[model samples]
Target: MAFDYDQYIRGGKLPHIWCPGCTYGIVFKSILRVVDTLKLNRDDIAMVSGIGCASRLPGYVDFNTLHTTHGRALPFATGIKLSKPDKHVLVVSGDGDATAIGGNHFIHACRRNIDITMLVFNNFIYGMTGGQHSPTTPSGHLASTMPYGNVDPSFNIPELAKGAGASFVARGTAYHAAGLDKLISGAVQHKGFSVVEIINACPTTHGRRNKFKSPTDMLLWMKDTFLPAVAFDKLPAEKTAGKFPMGVLFKKEGAPEYCETYYGLVERLKKQREGRA
Candidate 1:
């Protein structure tokens, strides 16, 4: 049976703003499929995002959504998760929005181990904001701000999330649309801070500047470069030099979720007050 996307999509919001050959639409559909498979209630989900092309996603989804200031999506989502601990809070962010200006929040959110799922769209460039070099931009990559090629080393987002105490960390690419659905579903079901760094293509900016013949070429690169986690682990180190692993790279069970701990404290205080009375 064909899945009815109309129920999940916002009315009259079609003609999305993404450029031709952009893969955000594929990512968006993968997310929707995950939500449907989970049998999630739209009313019980809250999607939040900051300023970026990826951040525009929440506006098109029929859920409780927030489009906030640049680099502040985590903080806002944190608040929602803390206040309504039962709700499934998700954040959609870009490479620049998640790891550049929002870098501090990204790590701290992991440190706190909050129950929020963050999907980072890592196109390696600031696709919406003049094609600047983002923190994830590979060294020697071209961007509007680095026409001579970027000098800074790029961040490995999954490793960074693991180092910062995220209980769940995974990665997927736009080319592996089916795999992305599984990765996102796992992140959403995880009880503590979960980060899914989605490798994406920005043909208009990053691709054109970096000499990718077309978006198809960029996607093919993803298909070739990223290996499934099990397959990736079996390869010899030298053979895996330019490749990356997909699927859940790290997961720590039994970590205390931030909201649960805070609400537990509140309940304990209430009991103390009752004893005083």
Candidate 2:
């Protein structure tokens, strides 16, 4: 049976902030599918996002939303989780907001293993604030700020997430909506911190300047770039060694969750205060 997205989407806003044929819509759709499949109460959920075209996700979704300061979605989400541990909290931000300016918060969020799901929209460039190069922009990738192509190396997002102690980490591209939806849905079900990096399309910014003739061409390029986890593994040792494999990059067990730990600390302190009182 096909998923009826009509119930979840805002009908009045038939269109979205993304450019025509952009994969951002596909990524956004996957997220909505996650919420629906999880049977999550949208009213009880809170989504926080930083500044970017991708940041508009919270606004589009009918949830308790917060459009926060640029590069601060993690902190904002952390506070939300700390205050309302029972709520289903999701944080959505672009590559620059998650990896560059908000880098500190991102690592600590992973370190804490808080029960929060983070979505990283990796459009490669800073699409919202102009076509500048973002943290995830690959070396030699052209951008408005780097007409000669970007000189900085890109971070392997899933690898960084796994290394930072995230309980669950996964990667998928916007072009693969069903796969992305399943991965995101799985992330939402996990009890501890989960990070899913969805390589999205910035056709107007990342594509236009990079020589992609149209948005469809850009999406097709994304599809071509993906190597299945098994396919990646089958590649010769040297060939597979450097390429990023998209799947459940890492999953660990027995890690202490942030909310439960913080609450335990507060309880212990309260007991001490009672003794003094």
Each prediction's whole-model lDDT (CA): 0.96, 0.86
The C-alpha TM-scores of every prediction are 0.98, 0.92
Where is model 1 more than 4 Å wrong at Cα?
none
Model 2 lDDT at residue 211: 81
Q: Candidate 2 — what's its lDDT? A: 0.86
| Candidate whose TM-score is highest | 1
The digit string of per-residue lDDT tens for model 2 on 1-277 reads 9888778765576667777766778887788888887889988899999998889877777788899999999898898899999999999989999999999899899999999999999989998777999888878889988999899888888888889989999989877777997889888888899999998888888888888888888778767777777788788878854456777778887689999999999999999999999
Per-residue lDDT of 1-277 in model 1, one digit per residue for the tens? Answer: 8888878999999978899989999999999999999999999999999999999999999999999999999999998999899999999999999998999999999999999999999999998877999999999998999989999898999999999999999999999998999999999999999999999999999999898999999999999999999999999999999999999999999999999999999999999999999
lDDT of prediction 1:
0.96
